[model samples]
Target: MNTSQEQAEQLFAQSSSEMQADHFDTAEALLVKALNMDPRLAEAHANLAWLLDRRGSVSEAVRHYELAIELQPDNARIHLNFGATLAELKFFHAAEAAYHKALLVDPTLPGTWCNLGALLAQNGRDDEAETMLGKALALDPAHVAAHFNLACLLLRKGRFEEGWHHLEFRDWYHPAEERLRCRRWKGQSLQDRVVLVMCEAGFGDMIQFCRYVAVLRAQGAAQVDVLSHPDLKPLLQTLDGVGDVFAMDDDTSASDWDYWVPVMSLPLYSGTRLDAIPAVIPYLQAPADRLVYWRQKIDQLSPRPGLRVGLVWHGNPAFENDAQRSLPSVQTLAPLWRVPGVQFFSLQKGNGEREVKRFQATQPMTDLAPDLKGFADTAAAIEQLDLVISVDTAVAHLAAALGKPCWLLLPAFMTDWRWLEERTDSPWYPQVMRLWRQPTGNDWAPVVAQVQAALQAWAQPVKPAN
Candidate 1:
């Protein structure tokens, strides 16, 4: 090779090694020096783009990736990286174009296909997403990420079996192998083992999967212990078959449990079906004293008995689609305001004060949430209310678990596992909850209108007995 080419190759090798070591700053510096020596070095530009993307400088990464693509237009891997960066920046259309370009350059690139599938899924094109993901899996069956992503898509489409089948790939995606290892109990017989069921993921997921505890016990688990968030311990302990309950943060290594199953997988292992779902309501009960206190508080508010509605118009701000799924202010629920004799109480928490203030200005509403210190208080308040009108949030799950009626407002493209494509009822919450879905992408008006109609029906007074 020529002297300049030889020097460029050496610098590229050194920078690649540094990148692998995660010395991102050092790798970026080396890649820059190599690019200066040889402007046509496609690898250096791609490597620099990768380092910049990792550092969260997505715009800068995009510029470098575009330059690299210009230099080596046929490089499928560079196109994949560029597309992924664009997706991170929420440039979905551009990202889709980049993925398509990559596929055109090299149709058999399974990774690029998977990236394209994810972009399509995010953009609410599930059918196209599924097709691309299937293509990816056909190219490489054991591709764990493709399997996992495909499972998510299927779950969103309400295809439980396929979704769960693909979900089995989660263990492969974990960075640490130890995190994937299921706790096993060695027993003289299968019936003799004490199984500890640990809850992971979001609170809603834990609530949804907690339905399977009774099923696990039926499978002959001698004792079923539960390790979950501290907030859930008080309520979960009341569920049948839950022998012992401990906080997740608590040191459970010292506890004597033979086997452990992550909550969600219990359904898969036990071969649970939707119809066979244990429809036991009020599995979680509030403490009597707390319930009494909330009842007295509600009495003081003098809320009418016909339709005592609890309102939660917002969810956690950190949630990915919180801006779309959750309203910024309770005033957005103006339809509910017009429903006569329907009393409203705020069940929201954390940055919900502004929304409460907005509601007070426009509607005659009570703020019960300020005194609600934790999930325990929230549970107590929910027990007192006739019905809960909430966005897709932990509070809705809490209300449903306690056997209270809940009106859940869902986004067009909701969380994968809710799985109600266009239905008004949830298989997860059974009789205690009703669903109102958005008509189009992120539009809450139609859903709110539906909830208003439901509220009007609920608010009609009955005749008095002689």
Candidate 2:
């Protein structure tokens, strides 16, 4: 090789090593230097793009990947990387074009196919996505990422049984493998074992999966321990068959335990049938003191006794579909204001308070959340309320578990597991809950109108107590 070519190769090697070591700044500098020395260095540009993508600078990464593709338009890997980054940014159309270009250049690139499938699935093209993902798996049977992505696609399509089966392949995926290596206790038999169940995902996921604790115990697990977020710990501790429950920082490994299960997977292991779901009411109990305090607070608020309505307008902002699934507090409260003689209390938290203030300006509403703290306080308040009217949030789960009447307002394409598909009730929250699904995607107005009518009808006969 020529001197300049050899030097470029050395820089590329050194930059690759630094990137592997996670010294992104140094790697980025070296990669840029190499590119400056040889503008035709597609490998260096690709490496730098990968590093930037890993650092969460996806837009910058996309620029670099575009440059790399310009340098070597036939490079399937560069096209695939650029496509994946575009998908992350929700630039679905661009991502699709990039993935298509990659496949045209080299159809054998399974990662590109899998990602293309995922993007297709996200855009409501499930059949095509499934076909693409199947092709990816056929290309490489051991491709664990393809398996996991396919599982997600199937889950999105509401094929839970097959979905969960393929989801087990997540252990072989890169990021999931690192997370799964945490200290886990495994036992031959569950009968005498103290199984520690850990919460792996979001608050809604924890709530959805908490239903499995009893199923695990019934499956011959002698004792069940749960390591969950502190906010959820108090309520989860009251669950039936839960032996020990603590926050994530608690050292459950120090105690005697036989096995560990992620909360979400309990249903698969226990062979939980839809009919056999533990629908026991008040599975989660509030602390006595907290309950008494909330009761007194409600009494002081002098809320009209009949059909007390608790309202939550926002969910965690970090959730991918939060903008589509959640509503501004004022919009949520607008319909509830039309319901006469029903007391509307704010169950909203976080920045939701701003919207609550706007709603209170036009309606007679009470803020019950200011003094209310974590899930325990929320649970206590839900217990006191006659019903909870909420968006897709942990409060909805808390209310359902507490056996309070709950109206769950859902997006048109709701979360995979909610699976109502335009139904008025959720089989998951069997008792004391009704679902109000949006008729069209990103349209909350009609759903709110329905809620207004329902609440008005519900509050008709009940006069405010003297």
TM per candidate = 0.84, 0.85
**How many pairs of residues collide in each model?**
1, 0
Alpha-carbon deviation at 329 in model 2, angstroms: 6.0
The parts of candidate 1 lying over 4 Å away from their true place are 1-61, 88-92, 122-127, 172-190, 303-306, 351-353, 463-466
Q: CA lDDT, every prediction? A: 0.79, 0.77
Q: How would you encode candidate 1's per-residue C-alpha lDDT over 185-279 as one tens digit per residue? A: 32223375677777777787787678777766777878788878788887777787778888866766567766777776766676556555566
Candidate 2, residues 60-103: lDDT per residue as tens digits?
88888988998999999889988888887778899999999999
Report each candidate's C-alpha RMSD, comma-separated, in the order given: 3.9, 4.0
Q: Which regions of candidate 2 fall more than 4 Å away from where they truly are?
A: 1-15, 25-40, 43-63, 142-144, 156-158, 172-189, 274-276, 328-333, 357-360, 462-466
